[model samples]
Target chain A: MLVLKNIGVTFDGGTSIGSTILNGINLRVCGGEFVIIIGGNGAGKTTLFNVISGLLRPTTGQVMLDGKDMAKIPAHERSQYVARVVQNTMAGTMCNLTIFENLAFAFTRGKRRKLLPYSTSARRKIFAEKLESLGIGLEKRMNATVASLSGGQRQAIGLLMSVLAPSKILLLDEITAALDPKISDSVMALANKIIVAEGRTTLMITHNMAHATAYGDRMLLLANSHFQREFSGPEKEALTPSELAKVFGEV
Target chain B: MNTLEIVSGVEIGLIYGIAAIGICLTFRLIDFPDMTCDGSFVLGAAISGILIKSGCNPWLALCAATLGGALAGLATGIIHSFFKISNLLSGILTAFMLYSINLRVMGGVPNIPLIGAATIFSGASAIAVLTCTCLTVVAIFTYLLATDFGLALRSVGQSKGVSTNYGVNIRLANAVALMLSNALIGLSGAIFNQHQCFADISQGVGTLVIGLAAVMIGEKLFPCWSYLLIVPACVVGSIVYRIFIGFALHSEILGLKTQDLNLITGLLIIIAMAAPKFRRRSC
Candidate 1:
């Protein structure tokens, strides 16, 4: 379970030079629930995610993961329970490393890295199987540097790396915003499949109404640093893109 | 150049290769233009030379020199990571501070002649020592790069965001890399002092240029190779660079002198940098 209670984030140290980015934002996500959050520009959606993931500490609030207070945790330390994938194609992965190298790194996420063998045959086999399961034939090019891959492929690898972590919650920040429409839909499908299969709590931010309405078990409309509306179960399942577009219009 | 001159070039080149590997670790892998190598190199020589002169074991002197270099690297890492200073400026600051420390290490003397002193390879043939040491160091470095710790170091270099997101201790990785790199460089300085039987505070001048030249030459020579192969490739590149200088020094045709060493190195670097562009144009 992930919970955000009365979260508020203000830029510029909230002192002489400051602007409130998030205000009294409260949210809770249970295991096996995929929450899709949509907002217009300057909606504080990203800041909310950052606060939840411990990248930015909120001025007033508490972040709880599995009923434990996570407000004091640092970003890297919080990664033990929370994994995040950012929007930039280049942000979530290392370009100088090979696919296998990247996977090997992800395999040790939130864990102490030792002088142990990085390319053990068993670990290699497991990574290979994971890649093969993607059905993208990436297993054949494990040795190729991430710099040589396409944007879609890079994003795929980013998602793959995030899921492989021993995380209780997955936070995605516009994961497909950089890809083409076709690739974006495919990635969405892959993410949905993985989230359901893993039964992990997920929070995904998207700008596209179709994506917001098409996937996830719940939908949230955020505006002016607050949750304006929420739909779940039958309402979320019956939500339409036109209804989401109307919400955006009102915002 | 005669065979003896060529052999001398190879010997010195291999020694420089070790230092160049250290430079490569930061400049290429971690994207840090670490100027700490300049002062740390001389620091190593000063410490090693003084230790040997005090009748300490030669092996112990070398180890102490390596540790001194690691300390220099750690200082730079601390300033860069903790103070939020730019990486280049932090290295420069550390290098500047090390000069005073280095002079003190050598008893306030700018030069220390280690003649008749026990050295790490005092009884061995110079060429044999160079060959054996180069092979072992290169092998160990290559193996290190193939480990999990190495991957984390490289990851931080590639993307700090990704590294942090995945729980990689960025500061720790940076410090570890700089320590290892400077340790190798200090080893080079120690070995060079032993081989030449002298240590001078000014010996580290233009050290960065030489290492940069070697790394560029190595990358030019072998653009694609495994991690292990790439390391030895750097060593070979360093040797070839020294050979070019040797040929220029012994020139019977160009009327070149030893004093023109810097000019020739600069020219070679220019050529190396432009080679790929010229190749693409021709194609």
Candidate 2:
């Protein structure tokens, strides 16, 4: 479970030039719940993710992850409990390294890395099996550098990396935004399958109306630096993309 | 060049080649352009020279010198990681501080003579000893880079954010890398002191430039995308660079002087760095 209480972020706080980006934002995410967030430009969705992930310390808030106050925990340590996939495909993986190397990195998440040899043949076989299951055709090119992969492939790898290791929560920030619609659909379906299978508590931010309506057990519209609307259960299931878009335009 | 000059060139090359590997660890492996080589190189010499002069064991002196260099690297890492100073500035400050520390370690002297001192190279042919030492260093580094910790360190160098997201302590990895890197440079300095029978204050003047030149030249010549070959390539690069310098110095028709060595190294680095760009353009 993840809980954000009285979360607020102000740039240059208490100064004449101070500007509040997020104010009095509160949210609670139960375990195994898939939550989708929709917002227009600069609605502080990514900022909220940043605050939770410890990239930026909130000006004021208590981030409770499974009853632990994560305010003082640094980003690297926080990652043991929180995994994330960034919007920029390139930002999620090392481009110069082989795909196998990137996966090796993910495989050891939350574990102490020692002087042992990295990625035995058996481990490579396991990685290849995982990739094959994704149907991404990346199993054969495990040694190839990630720079040669397309955007959709990279995003899929990013998603795979987040799920490779267990964490208290997973954050996906517009991970499929850069992919073509067909690839995006498959990636989203794959993400949905993984999250459901793993029973992971996930928060995904998107601008797509259809993705907003189609996925996630709960949907939230973030506007004016706060949760303007939240839809769940039968209401979320019955919500149409056109109706969501109409409400999205009003705010 | 005569056989003796060429052989001595390789002997010197083998010793400095260890330093080149250190440069490779920082500049290539982690993409950290560390300037601590200039100071840590002399720090090693100073530590080993003073310890040897005080009747300490030669091998122990070498180890202490390496530890000193690791500490110097730690200083730079702490300053950069904790204080949020720029990476270049962190190395520069550490190197600058080390200048005075090196003098103090040498008992306020600018140089120390190691003549008649029982060094590790005392009972052996300098070339054979240096060659063995260089190969061992290369092997150790090759092994180290293939480990899980090496992957973590490399990831930190490639992308800090992604490394952080994957639970890598970037600051810690950076510090460890700098420590390992400067430790090798320091060891090279200690060996150089034994090789030359003296340790001068200004002996490390162009150490970073020389190591960088060797690394770049090695990559340009071999062009291996694998990490396994890159470590050995740095040593090869050093030997080649030294041989070329020997040839240049010996050529009477070229009319080049010993003072031009730094200028030549600078020019070589420029060409090596720009070579890739030119190749990319042609493609």
Candidate 3:
């Protein structure tokens, strides 16, 4: 479970230009809950994820991960508690490393790194099995450089990597936004299945309203630097894109 | 070549190979084309020469040299990371400053002579049957790289975002990588000073080019997927590159003087840089 209590983030644009990105925002995700956040441009959605992932520290409140205050933890130290996928496909994997090597790195996440001499074969086999579960042909290309992977393939791998470690929370920041619709659907379906099967708590941000409605158990909308609305179950299902848009004054 | 010449060439090659591996590690794993190797190379030599002349043991001198290199690298890493300086600029600035630092370390000398001091390769064949020894060190390094920390460092080079997502301390990784890289370079410098019986500050000049050349040559020759093969190939490539340079300098046909070494190095770098482009065209 994760909780953000009365979080606020302020930016000093200049001596004269001061702006607050998030103001008194509160959010909670129970264990095994899937939360989709829908927002238009500049809705502080990504900022919220950034705050949660320890990329940005909130000025006013605390970020509690499993009841521990995590606002002071550095981004790299947060890997043990949170794993995230960014909108940029290349942001989630090392492009120069082979698929299996990347997975090996992921498997050893949140641990002290050492130099061990062993053939990558054993680890490659394990990664292959995991890849096969994604139903992606990445299992066969364990030795392939991530540079050669398609955007969708990379995103799928990124999703899988985030869940590879036993982190308490997974953050998806429009991870499939760059892929083609078909690939996007496939990646989403895979993510849905993986998150559900693993029973991992997830907070996914999306530009697509339909995805917000269809994928997760809960939905929240951001506007004016705060959560403007929250919906769940049948209420979230009954809401249409136009109605959702109206709530944010987009319609 | 005669056995003696072959042995000498191989020994020299292995020494350079160690430096090349250090250079390649910073390049491939940290994604930084760190030029501090040039200054750190000389720094190592200077430190080792001073210590050895002062009656320090050869191993202790080598350790001191490695530490000196690590400090130099740490300085460069701090300038780059904290000051938001570009990688290339950070290396260049640090290397430039190291010229003065090396001078201070050597008590204002342009070079230091080892004279009768012992070296790691002392009593070794000109053919340097030290391959087995070098291989052991290489194996240890390779194994360390396969560990989680090494993977994190590699990830930093590959993708900063991903590495951070995995909670890899990028700044720490960068610092450690640079330190390790320069430490190895320093070790090579110490060895080189002992082998030649002298350490010249100018020896570090164009060292980065030599390292890049070795890496380029290794990738060209082996072009393998495995790090085990690629790492050794880099060492071999460094030696081969050195041999070719040495032969070119020694050849009567070239009519080149020792003072023209920098000119020759520059030309070699141009050729190396262009080789990939030429290969693309041919393909």
Candidate 4:
């Protein structure tokens, strides 16, 4: 389980040399539950993600993963328990590296990077099979560099990479923002499939209302430096894109 | 030019090729502008010279020089990552500090003569010795860049965000890369000092430029995308560059003298860098 209690972030800039970006946020995500957070510009959605990923330390309160306080842990160490996929397609994957190489890197995530060759026959077979599941024929092009792939293809590969390693929590930070609507739908579907198959606790933040309502077991609206509303079960199932949009504008 | 001049050029090229490979690692692979190359080169020479003069085994002295270079790289990495200094400035600062360190290593002397002291080249032919050493270093690095750690290293250069998310310690990777890069440069410096029978503190001047020229020339000439080919290309480019220099020095017809080497090298790098742009514009 991943839990955040009384988390707050204040940027060191502005009239008073500080401005609050996030405040008094409390969240608890159970194992295998998918949570979606929706927010407009400057609503501190990314900051909240950063705080959970240990990229930013909260001004107050605690981030607990499996009942262990992780506020002091660095991002790289926190990654052992949490896997994140960012919005920038190029940010989540190494473009210059080959598809096989990129997958190989994710395959050994959180593990010691030994001096041994990363791609053995056995590992290569596994990577190819994983790519094959994407239905994009990336398996046949394992030797091709990621830079040569399209944006949607790269993001798909990025999503695959995050789930390749075993982790308790997966944070998808607007990962489909750069892709077209159709591509984003497919990527989201793949995400849902992976989350169900692996039963991982996931937190996905998005600006797309449709995506926000379509995939999550629980949905949270973040505005004015805190969660404005939380919907789940039948309440979340009854949420429509227009109603969510109206609520977003009202806040 | 006589056959002897060509032979000497090849020897110098092979020795300096190791430094060029190091340059490729920092500048090309890791995207770090490592100015530490200049001082580390001299550091290598000084360490090897001091040890060899003190009657230490020449091979052991070479190893020490390599480690000394790695330390210089580590210093830069620490300043950059730990202290939050910019990469370029961190390298410049380390290079500045290494000047005094190199002088101190040579016991306050700016130059040391290795003449009459048994060196690695005591009996081995310069060509045979350098070729063997260069091949060995190249093979080892090729194997290194093909490993899991190599992937992590390259990923850190490509995207720090993804590297962190994947559990890579960016600072540690940068440090390791710089250490490996400077170690190779140090090896070349030690070889150069032994080959020339002297270690001059000023010999490190323009070392970075020379290495850059070799790396650029190799990539421009061979134009391969794979690191596997790019690694060897560094050596080939160094050899080719040295041959050109050899020709320029002997070309009285062109009114070129040995002192004009640096001037021509700077111009050559500019032309090489701009040529691709010109080609693309024309196309």
Candidate 5:
């Protein structure tokens, strides 16, 4: 449901200093497809997500979602179609607000914000039901400040928040990288469950190769700012971590 | 304190609290230590005073003051966002320009009086603190923070990158957040002018410091789970801080003259700023 055509982004440091982050990169994801992207630092994985989310304008490219060109759309306007979870735990949620309040904000995404009085009763009920489905016991603490939450709990909330809006696309940028392994497993499991249940298209970036192979339906390795290899279906299932690393020359 | 004194204290406290909440929103959420509060507060008073003197409705005057403060904040946001200026410097620049703007608004005078004017709090007593005007503003601010747009504003303050990823336009959100913050401060200024019967340009000189003090005190007192509680805590804290200052002024043993208000305020800020450091070390 998403396609990027020759997306290129360049940053100018000074008159004599300039760098290209992404060079004519092309990618596509169909509906209900979960794509795992693995890359080293500065491989333009995040930049690719940023371009798709309308946070950065490609110097020369077109981003189309479900066949609609989003080149002219602003970031806030694109929220109705794309939802993103960032690398920082604090970035995924408002630390100062309660879980319910953050969820309320997500519920009204892409709408004009106004200063109206809020009644937490209905919001609490909805959040509680959603939290119960995750079996995380977060429903009981709807009024708790997000800052007080553990990293895993926060990530779960972040994942739930991304899918709360009726958006067609979800971007996960190292979301579980900050959590402990056990917590990360639960979160990944939850992510797989939600994506499959909702039939939403997802693009997840991870540094861990095990997670890349274990989670998504397809995996692609990014090298030197370009897609170097693609693995999927039985081919992905048969590939081992060591063999995958050998192909990328890290073994 | 007598009922009359308590009523007066509460009214004054509520006004300062409103301004303090605005300061807290920008400081804590947006991570912008905005000094525009000082100029915006005075600008609010000046604009409201001028409009009231021209026979405008008190409500309309208040609206003009809020818009004036919003414009000042917008100017600061534009400077910071477009020019990549430091947040503090941008606030300082806007505040410095507002001094002259406020002067012009008051026709070169430093103060304006509203001796016989009708204010929203004209007939409000201790029991009637939640007047129609107060209720309306509270409702409006509460709604603004609860809405999706408000969430985007909070997200921007939390993390610029996350906000962008959420499809929230950081520039627009920052601009609107600053405008709303300064507008609230302006509303307080309009209320204060009517209550005090005069608006002095010097009244806002230490407004930012006062706001910081209120926020610090509120956070210490409430320490609640919900973000919305910060709003009322700031209101209460402002009044409590003022009451503390009033007590110090009235105590014969302290020998603190009323004119030494600025000195006391400065000292209070020093104590407040140091208290956090001490707590961190202790922990």
Candidate 6:
């Protein structure tokens, strides 16, 4: 579960050449609830994620992780409870390192990293098995540099990496936007499968109306600096893909 | 080259090889454009030379120099991260400040001579000492890079946004990488001053260039070395670079001399850089 109370972010103290991006916003995500969000440009969707993840401090609000105030915690510290997947393929993995090394990094996330071996032969076997399940043939190429992988493969790994270690929350931000249509479907399918199987509270942002209406137990439309509409339970399941697309409207 | 020339080349090369490994940590591993190695190198030599002159054990002086250099790197990191200074400017400012601090550390002297003192290489053969020291440094460096912390640092360099998403503190990783890099350079400075039995303030001016050249040479020689073997490649590159330099200086038919050292080094780096591009084109 997660709670954000009256979050606001303003640049330059909002006095001289200043602007406010996120203002008076509140959101609550229940346990095991898959929440889908749709927002236009500068709707403060990413900023909301940033505030929750402790990367950006709100000007007049606090973030609560399971009712615990996270205003003082740094981004790195917040990662203990929250896992994030980004849209950028390059940003999700280290190109210079092997797939095993990246998984090792994910496994040790939010934990103290001692000067001990991060991956052994046994660990490699487990990692290989996990990669094999991705159906990308990444298992045999455990030692191969991640740079050599395609964008879709990288995002699949990124998604898996976000779930590698135990956590309560998962954030997916336009993760499949860059992939080809065929690849995007499978990656999103895999992501959905993992989120539901783990029964984790998940928040995902996407521009696809079909996905918003087709997946998740709830939907939130963020517009004009705050959450404008919310649907859940029966109302959420009743919404159609065409109705979701109409919500975006003509400029 | 004669035995003395070859011996001197290996000894100096080993010392610089250690420094090159340090440079590789920032430039290659973390992809950080760190320019603080110049000041740290001289600071290492100056601090170690001062301590050895005051009857301290050579090894202890070297350790102190390493810590001191780390502190210097920390300052650069603070300026860059907290003050939001550009990374290049941060290193340049710290390096400028360290120039004066190095002189002050040596009692406002421009140089210190450590002749007839108990140094790390006082009784050991030049070849043996250099070989042992290079191996030890490479071992420690490789081990560090293979750890989770090292992976985090590399990730930070590779992509800050991704590292953030993964919960890595970008600034902390940068600071730690810079500290480790400069510390190794500091130790190299210690060995250098001991081998030459002197420390001069101006000696650090061209140090970064040499370290960069060594990294380039190493990568060129072994393009496919993984992160583990890459450490040894850097060390080997430093020695091979030094040997190349020594040979170029000693050549008679080509009419090369010591004064042409800088020209040759610059040309070698250019050639190494261009070789990869040419290979790709040919392929």
Q: Which predicted model would earn the best lDDT?
A: 2
* Candidate 5 lDDT tens digits, B166-250: 5667777778779988998998888778767788888788889888888888877887635566566777788888888778887
What share of the reference contacts survives in each candidate?
0.78, 0.85, 0.85, 0.82, 0.53, 0.71
Selected candidate, larger TM-score, 2 vs 4: 2
Q: What's model 6's lDDT at B11? A: 78
Tens-place lDDT digits, model 3, residues A1-251: 89999999888844478888889999889999999988888878898988888888777889999899996789999988898888999888888888887788888777666656323667767787999998877888888998899999999988888888888999999987999888988898899999999998999998776677789998988878898888987898898877776766751
Candidates in order have lDDT scores of 0.87, 0.91, 0.83, 0.91, 0.81, 0.86
Q: Judged by TM-score relative to the true structure, which candidate is superior, 1 or 3?
A: 1
Q: Which portions of model 3 show Cα errors greater than 4 Å?
A: A13-15, A117-122, A241-251, B1-8, B82-86, B129-133, B250-255, B278-283
Tens digit per residue, CA lDDT, model 6, B1-283: 9988887887788899999998999888878788899999999999899999999998899899999889988998999999999999999999999999999998998989998988987888878888987898899889988887887887887777768767788889999999999999888888888888999998788788999999988898888858778799888889899899988888888899788899999999898889779989997
Give the candidate order by descending DockQ: 2, 4, 1, 6, 3, 5
lDDT of 5 by residue, A193-237 (tens): 998899889999997666777788888887776787788867777
lDDT of 2 by residue, A1-251 (tens): 99999999999999999988899989999999999999999999999999999999999878999999998899999999999999999999999999999999898999999998897998898898889988979999999999999999999898998999999999999988989999999999999989999999999999878888888898888899889999985787787889888898999
Give per-residue lDDT, candidate 4, residue B72.
93
How far is each candidate from the true structure, as Cα RMSD in Å? 1.6, 1.2, 2.6, 1.5, 3.3, 2.0
Query: Which of the predicted structures, 3 or 4, would earn the higher DockQ when compared with the native?
Result: 4
TM-score of each: 0.96, 0.98, 0.92, 0.97, 0.87, 0.95
DockQ of 2: 0.86
- Backbone collision tally, model 3: 15
Model 1: residues >4 Å from true position, as ranges? A13-17, B278-283
Candidate 2 lDDT, tens digit per residue, B1-283? 8999999999988988999999998888888889999999999999999999888998899899999989999998999999999999999999999999999999998989988989988889988888888888998999888988999989988898899999999889889999999999999999998788888899899999999888887887787578788889899999999999998877999899999988888988898888779999998
lDDT of 3 by residue, B1-283 (tens): 3556656777777878888888988997678989899999999999988887777887788889988999988998999989999989999999999999999988888877877666665677634445764686588677767676667777888878888888788888898999989988898888777778888889887778777788778877887656666578778888788777778777888898778877887788788779789999998
- C-alpha positional error of residue A159 in candidate 5 after TM-score superposition, expressed in Å: 1.4
Q: Candidate 3, what DockQ?
A: 0.67
Candidate 2 accuracy as TM-score:
0.98
> Candidate 4 has what TM-score?
0.97
Residue B82 of model 6, lDDT score = 99
